[model samples]
Target: MKTEQLINALVADIGPRRSFLRSFVYATASGVAFDAVVFFAAIGPRPDIAAAAETWRFLFKFVVTLALAVPATTLAYRLAAPAMWRRCRFEVLMVPLCLLLAATAFELDLVPPSLWMVRLVGSNSVNCMTLIPVLALAPLTCFLILLRSGASCDPGLTGAVAGLAAGAIAATFYALNCFDDSPLFVITWYPIAMSTTAAGGYYGGRRFLTW
Candidate 1:
């Protein structure tokens, strides 16, 4: 109850909080690094990545993916804490949603109607859907395991968010090798891939995170 005792107690509480956060960071980094190694070793970046980088559409992929990753990761981390979970602003997700929508519209307007379906389908639709989730597996596993240490009110939702974050992170790397840069392709297939991961997360969370 004394001032010194109260300060010491607060510091003690902060120590574990900081440690948990650090662990989350380390888990994420390690998961991503593992994914990167697998990606480069097996599927490496597109040979023409330098030329691809010159295009706005190609660069925008990173923008949209990173946008999604940042907010989803933050929400997942916040959800790990019982008190902070309620305060997390889900609206941050709108940034990536808006960006994808605007780009899709522009792509639709710029291309011919006949080409719309082609762009949406892309050459790698199947691969896009398959690989993103595959790449996300490591990160999603790491996130779900990390979440176990926290007290989340809605385990399924927290897991879903972690899956979304993992998917986004995977997509960012996948973009480097993806030849399809059209927003139409991105809008259509990327969600399917990421949603697959999110679905997995939901199931995992419900199965594991529950007290």
Candidate 2:
């Protein structure tokens, strides 16, 4: 076909449905993954909440979560590897932003981190930094699912995805850490994280759409 005809066809094919679906999926996955991961990380080990005097179950579970989260996230990344790899600039900025946010949040007492992990250094900034590295799991999961389904990023929808992804991931992590104890963390940090994710996702989406 001619160039103008081809352009019109392409526009009609992917115009809004793709964008809407992409946003919807990304948001849904963010929420779902966050909830599941948090549940497993915080409550998987503790059967009898009342009987256990020590909250050491979290210690065990935290290690398990990290071990599990890393591989899980890695696999997800690999699945979405093409899109992720394509956004090298996002990845580059993402690392430092993750570090800054995590540290700032913890130094501000955003969430109580793994006990041993927190106490070992005693810097009060360690938890955030440590935690931030793994925060991308939700986004990667969402991204992977999108890529696998052959859905492309929607222009003007990325912020929403990023926000939902970030929020969902934060909620999951906070829920785990706060399981039965950290309500303050849940109430405070979950929203903060989600908002951050939304903002980032939207901005990132804007960038992705442009290229």
Candidate 3:
């Protein structure tokens, strides 16, 4: 059967909209909860969290991450249904992108040029890259399973969005533990980690989401 026909049939038989929404909520919540458990157990928040919270750089991490997370999650959920996928606007992601860019610019203007490389290659670059994806694994799996249940016309794209959401979620948690608060480090390293997860999602979508 053609992909459109399959999507139509899946939509017809996919039950009520509420069911999908409920499942989406549950799946995301459960996945985030699991990631949180792993974070607390393996690597709790930084010891200086209280003091760090006062700093604009530290607080801005959550601002950017959660900004990315909210829209990415919304887009991922919308993409689960092939009927709604096309209507989902990916431009929403630009909010976070612009925010990061602005912050990076501000950082560059405020900090000396000599320290640019130092801030960009923060002390925990290796750990930040490693842990974001590790933390995202559960959420990515949950999102892929959820996406599979619905019929996405563009499974690879849907999976990529799911991975983005999962990566953002993981990054939010990891931000608490990460000592690197510079927007320079975040812009440089966070994308590398999330892109890694998104690539995994794209490959998984191609392999499993096909009829």
| Collision pairs in model 3 | none
Q: Which ten residues in a row have the lowest lDDT in candidate 1?
A: 78-87
TM-scores, all models, native as reference: 0.97, 0.35, 0.92
Tens digit of per-residue lDDT, candidate 2, span 1-211: 9999999998997665567455645555675567567556743433444454355433332333233333333323322323443532334324423443454455447445555344333332233333432464455345533533433345334334444544444434543433333222322333454455556555655555333
Error of 3 at 187 (Å): 0.5
For residue 114, model 1's alpha carbon misses the true position, in angstroms, by 1.9
Which model scores highest in lDDT?
1
Q: For model 1, what is the alpha-carbon lDDT of residue 193?
A: 95
Candidate 2 differs from the real structure by a C-alpha RMSD in angstroms, to one decimal, of: 12.2
Candidate 3 residue-wise lDDT, 1-211, digit = tens? 9999999988877666779989999999989999989999999999999999999999999999999999999998898787776678889898988999999999999999999999999899899889999999999999888777887788788888888889999999999999999999999999999999888888777766665
Order by lDDT, highest first: 1, 3, 2
C-alpha lDDT values of all predictions: 0.93, 0.43, 0.90
User: Which runs in model 3 stand beyond 4 Å of their true positions?
Assistant: 1-15
TM-score comparison, 1 vs 3, better candidate: 1
Query: What does candidate 1 score on TM?
Result: 0.97
Using TM-score as the measure, the top candidate is 1
